[model samples]
Target: MKVNIYYGGRGLIEDPTLYVINKIQDVLKEIRVNVGRYNLYEQKNGISMLPNTFKEADAVILAVSMEWYGVGGLMQTFLDSCWLYADKQRIKDIYMFPVVVATANGERKAVEDLRGAWELLGGRVCEGICTYVSNRIEFETNQVYASIIEKKAEEIYRIVSHKAPMLPNSINSCHVEIPSAGIELTPQESEQLSVYVADDSFVKKQKEDVEMLSQMYKSILGKKSQPDSEDDLLKKLEKAFNPKEASFKAVFSINLNDVNKTIVLDIDDGKLKSSYSSSAKADITVNAGKDVMSKITTGKTTFQGAFMSGLITAKGRLDLMRMFDRVFVFEY
Candidate 1:
């Protein structure tokens, strides 16, 4: 069934909360569910006024934050705009779920506001999940929240997977609320909260890198196996191309941008090996462990941002880097 998720928020002011929301999408995809996600921040009006892709979806989940007992300004505007469609029956039949990111102090208020908004739109209000991460939690601790969000996402998927053929008139049947806080944040204390907003510039760069690397890996992995006695450099080339029978090969190398690293990939087997050792020319040749390489190739890292920030570098044949796209096909 078609599934669409709408994420409306201001910015990445809190890393933990943002991490949780982002990871939830990954979890849904891992289970083979087709999901279309839209971030209100990137849109011109913060709401898709045109009939939303969510129209035909069996379920539509909205991820927004509560600042005090109210929805964030951006999210408020977005919801108000959505009334145009929801009121007209565009998304009237879709099951609606809300996920609110909030701090322990403001959790109740935030959730209440979200419920009010959901009901206002003639949408069913599912149980809401609240994720709390203290301001003191280091950004590195975000993984913890990611896991929590993933678990919450799993519960949501399960609910939608087995939803009653006809939802009851009541709106609370499908809500799953989670209120979390670090051990230090006592139940009584009021803590300021933040959500991690992905760097728009970085996310765009990362998407490009992931696409490039994914293509490279697919190409090399597609060819048949060759002899072990193949030239040493040729063997390395083949290994890079056909690592463990992967369909593509992504080679991380130094990039021209001081802030980013360049990824070179071999998408399909061609005669490129004929010029093996001329200079081994790639700026900052990277020899990543298989696991690390896989992550990079799969777009788990912000390659351009990493490179620009000095996380990656190049040494030779930088100009030939653009050849990657010509080598492999993008699967998605």
Candidate 2:
């Protein structure tokens, strides 16, 4: 498995975060993981193009130092570039592990922020290292600390190699649109602009070309690609129905998290009635993001598998919930 490490910390002699990431990288390499490391401080100029590196990565380590209150400007800028220029569909399939070492405070919050940002992009998250160090020499020299770091790295390697399933996160419920300066850039164009950003002649010419027209288009070209329509999803849900004789009657209220809509399935023996509304109370209330629901509809994931993985959540009669896939059978 290929694992990429993006170190957002400045290379300081006293930065324990640097030491931790090095240890993790070493452990990962010892296990024969194909590893790539990029120090963002050194490559600050090319960060806009860095997202393209996700192409070969099965998982990534987002290591940032909390020198003060947050994950620092470099990491934040890198994340912003990923949201604006990266192929988000590619990001969704990769796993992210966050490593934060704080000299002051807020290491846990920084990790949370990293996880939240990645999840907003629809990626999986693996557990990572978060710690505060008072003395860098003491922290790095300790054998126990080294052992723990080794184990975490090993665990991350195993997870990525296995292509593990993760519980769907809360970020699935909310996201902000990535605003564009002008046209939606292809990755190559985005990389070219990073070099052009410093050239006055190129900047002036590009701005002149986009000037008034940029405002006219606003975010028209940058708007997020939408998922399947509510009607289309509803039809798929209905079409997948496979009546079961054992259950006398059942009602399933499913919330499509991303679209902010709920669909109700009222099943009475062989008959089925499905519709959408803002509110729908039922015998079993299921909750999942649009992607998860699509998988269920397409028979890509079973209802039980979704529930067990926490991709699809159900409230009320969980026993009745287990019978859902049986009645509304989806096939490959």
TM per prediction? 0.46, 0.55
lDDT of 1 at 287: 30
| Model 2 CA deviation exceeding 4 Å by range | 173-332
Q: Where is the poorest 10-residue window by lDDT in model 1?
A: 188-197
| Model 1 quality (TM-score) | 0.46
lDDT by residue (tens digit), candidate 2, 224-330: 34455788778987888777684568888888888788988888868888888644458777888887676667666677656644466555555565677788777
What lDDT does each candidate get?
Answer: 0.49, 0.77
Predictions: Cα RMSD each: 16.3, 17.4
Root mean square deviation (Cα) for candidate 2: 17.4
- Per-residue CA lDDT of model 1 for 1-332, tens digit only, reads 44576666665656344555666667667545678877777774525352345445656777775545566766777676565333334344456667776654676667677777666555555664675545626543666554555556655665555442345555434453423433342232212111112235643554576567556545544643432222332333334332322353334342223223333433323323323232243332543233333333443443332222223433233222333323422222
Q: How far off is residue 196 in model 1, in Å? A: 34
Q: List pairs with backbone clashes in candidate 2.
A: none
Q: Which one is best on lDDT?
A: 2
